[model samples]
Target: MTLTEKQERALCVLDDLIDEGIDVTNLRQEIHLSNTYSYDAVRTRLRRAFGSVENALRAYGLYDQTAEPERLELERCFYIDQDYRVSENRYKSEELKELYGISEIKFQQYKKVLLENLEREALDIYVRDTFPYGLKRDYIYKHKLWHVEKYLRNFYGHSVRKLCEEWDFSYELFNDSYSSFYITQGHIFEGLVGEVLDAIYPGRVESQRRIENCIPDFIVNGRHWIDAKLSEKTAFNRASKTFSKYLKHTENLTIIYAQKSDGVYSFPNVTLVHISRYIPELIKIHRSDLIEKINAFLSNLKINIENVS
Candidate 1:
């Protein structure tokens, strides 16, 4: 059960980074490894180290506490590093793909591994109230993609470019890789909204359709245009800037956002009634009453219809 020199080194670096609240995306660049360590090499060493630890714990009847080796590795590799750019919910970084030989099939396997042994209660504690921070505690209580919430807060708290500079990663490259993750989140948000709409009026929701030069997210009853905005506060300014292009003066458009923010959005010359609310509210009432409320809400917005036809 003796730890390999590389395993010991990786763990040491990992602990240091966690203590410092440093993001672990560019660990290889941030810390110098005596030996050349590729993504695969580090992963292999971590796996072996985890097995060693688990075996030692088992010798003392503590194996059950350490039964989740794969999950433990993810906590060390992803959570401890606090790197939200790529995690279970996001697309893996290219370097990670190359390091782990992750194909489409392997990606699913990797996801399965990280998802095992995760407890929502622990994650709730980690986010709702500050507990003594430790990877061991996070592993015991991780909510799915807790890192994303952390990253959003970090990115909003300061300039993303400046933070990326600290890690020697290109901000543009990081954003590009992260756009997929962002888009995936958007899709999930939109899907929830769509379900609510469909329940009200079946077969009336048109999605991802191009009208004129703009493709709107949803068109209800061949008249009402709706766009769902589900973004962190950090991306609000950027998202607001692009709102005008899709929303014309003549378009019957309404925008619904997931979160309420004290920050104001600078809308274009166009006048529109945009509501800041989430799906939970929409799903709270009886289906018949919910439908009436949704229609009433959209009607109150007084959207202007564009003659795209």
Candidate 2:
């Protein structure tokens, strides 16, 4: 670990080649042109190993390279990558395309120079006594549905890291048995099944995590999961027998009950479906029962009968 301490030995082999998936443009070509040293001395030792920890393990990536105990997973990525959003830049998107805007004493002298640069960076003395909780713009959409464990990614992962962003020592191996619909209609049931279950399962539903063991409310497609209950009627009969231990992982569950008397009841292999009976012709009867199981697996694949000759 010491070619004159080559920036903490290339940040511990660039965090074990970014947990062995490698690809920060092949990790700057395997730390500068695969080893005979001197791609300008491995880019001056990876620019002083991302300038002495400002890269923080390439901004925190290497999460559990598949130890896979009790499904605690993590591989965070947030790439929108290309968007200068081509506009009249040079701030205020070029003062709204060079019409020279923002009067009212130049918007109170640019909000008094951004509160005097957050009171000379003490950030108002570390936000005075910090009263922040929930909805600070919803912690960027629950950390983008917890690094995309969307279709409920078999519920609860990031298996161990006692402290990444505060709490992550999570593990819940099995639980499944589902039926639920207890909404008073919020965001019109996520604007008609949340953009058609993230356009039919792009990495499976995760409305974020929380587990006293299962029912992390909202999942679909990557083998359908859901647990939403708005309460009352003796707390929806003790939360429908407490998600009957989510039938040990997956029974393609749902339990959406918003019945203030009338309409919406769909029960297939389980029962009680009503966010007003999950409308739009009961959500096209689940894409016409998955096009009748892909037309009964192409009518039992008769192998086109050509061999009958």
Q: Provide TM-scores for the models.
A: 0.31, 0.22
Estimate, for each residue in 5-111, the C-alpha lDDT of model 2 and write its tens digit.
55557766554543444433344465443434434554466667666333534333332122321211100111111110111114542333223332222323343
Model 1, residue 269: displacement in angstroms? 8.0
lDDT of 1 by residue, 1-309 (tens): 466675566565444543444323444564344233344554455557665433422322221331233443444343222321333423333445444444333334455555432322223223212211222224424745555445434443424455344433334433433444444545665765677767656799988776543456778888777767642242233344335545553356666655444656545432333332433445565555554554554443223111110
Q: Give the runs in model 1 whose Cα sits over 4 Å from its true position.
A: 1-181, 232-241, 266-285, 288-309
Alpha-carbon lDDT of model 2: 0.36
Worst 10 residues of 1 by lDDT: 300-309
Best by lDDT: 1
Question: Which candidate has the top score in TM-score?
Answer: 1
Clashing pairs in 1: 122-141, 123-141, 250-305, 250-306, 251-304, 251-306, 252-305
